[model samples]
Target: MENLSTIERILAAKQSLPGALLPILHDIQDALGYIPPDAVPSIARALNLSRAEVHGVITYYHYFRQTPPGRHVVRVCRAEACQSVGCEALATHVQSALACEFHATSADGDLTLEAVYCLGHCAVGPNIQIDETTLHARMTPEKFDRLLAELRSKP
Candidate 1:
């Protein structure tokens, strides 16, 4: 399959690097949106690690996803800083609004909502990241809906 070919290429390309597991996983995730379970054997063989090791690495990191993501990814900060600023309320709103919970895609598969520990913008707190690019701070339910509307409007 094409996924195997791509995975083989990535394994061949990065297998020689020092401390290659994390980078290899990152590259695969970047290219495929999520790491295919079938690719684990090839990756483990290339890295000279067991499938358990490979799977462990993937599971250890919050950033790694085992399945395909939705068209859009929405990450809301949940660190203590964000919590102080009412991020819990914001998170509740998001889950209710999208009818999706953290680490799960919406029913229509339009969006994925996740909880990120921190966005490094803790001073502002209550921050949200859209598709890992745009960052919004001091968010509220109203602002979230407006942003969601805008995203839905786009093709």
Candidate 2:
């Protein structure tokens, strides 16, 4: 899979849909781990869209990653529900402990920290999503550290 480029993956996924710019992009990201710079041209040609149009979509969505992500991604919910529960303080603690700001990966490459609008856990408040798994309710700084440690130890 390492030898397979983003263009190849995008072309392969393009066959499945008639007008699949979004889906193709999703699959390309899923396969390549991130949308490479080279993919813009290939995707544009395949979808008959301008290069600028393709780039615009990619840049517009925060979910799209231009660069490769770390092994683990940690997303903190920053919606009003979470904010009322002191999520800002927790976010600061997490950033300080990891030594990285929001939307950035740690220097060790163990984690990528991102801010999310909501996690649908408003009642619990101060929610976090680790990778594909969501953790709800009362997120403390210490608990976050334990979760980070657990993710770091994974293969």
Best by lDDT: 1
| Candidate 2 off by > 4 Å | 1-10, 15-18
Query: Looking at model 1, which ten-residue stretch has the lowest summed lDDT?
Result: 1-10
lDDT of 1 by residue, 57-135 (tens): 9999999999999999999999999999999999999999999889899999999999999999999979999986899
Q: After superposition, how far is residue 109 of candidate 1 from its true place, in Å?
A: 0.4
For candidate 1, report its TM-score.
0.96
Q: What's the lDDT for all of these models? A: 0.93, 0.84
Tens-place lDDT per residue, model 2, 1-155, is 35246566557757458768888878877776688877788788777789999999999999999998888888999889999999999999999988999999999988899999998989987899987775757899988888877777888
Could you tell me the lDDT of residue 125 within candidate 1?
76
RMSD in angstroms between candidate 2 and the native structure over all alpha carbons: 2.0
Q: Tell me, what's the RMSD of every candidate?
A: 1.0, 2.0
Model 1 clash number: 0
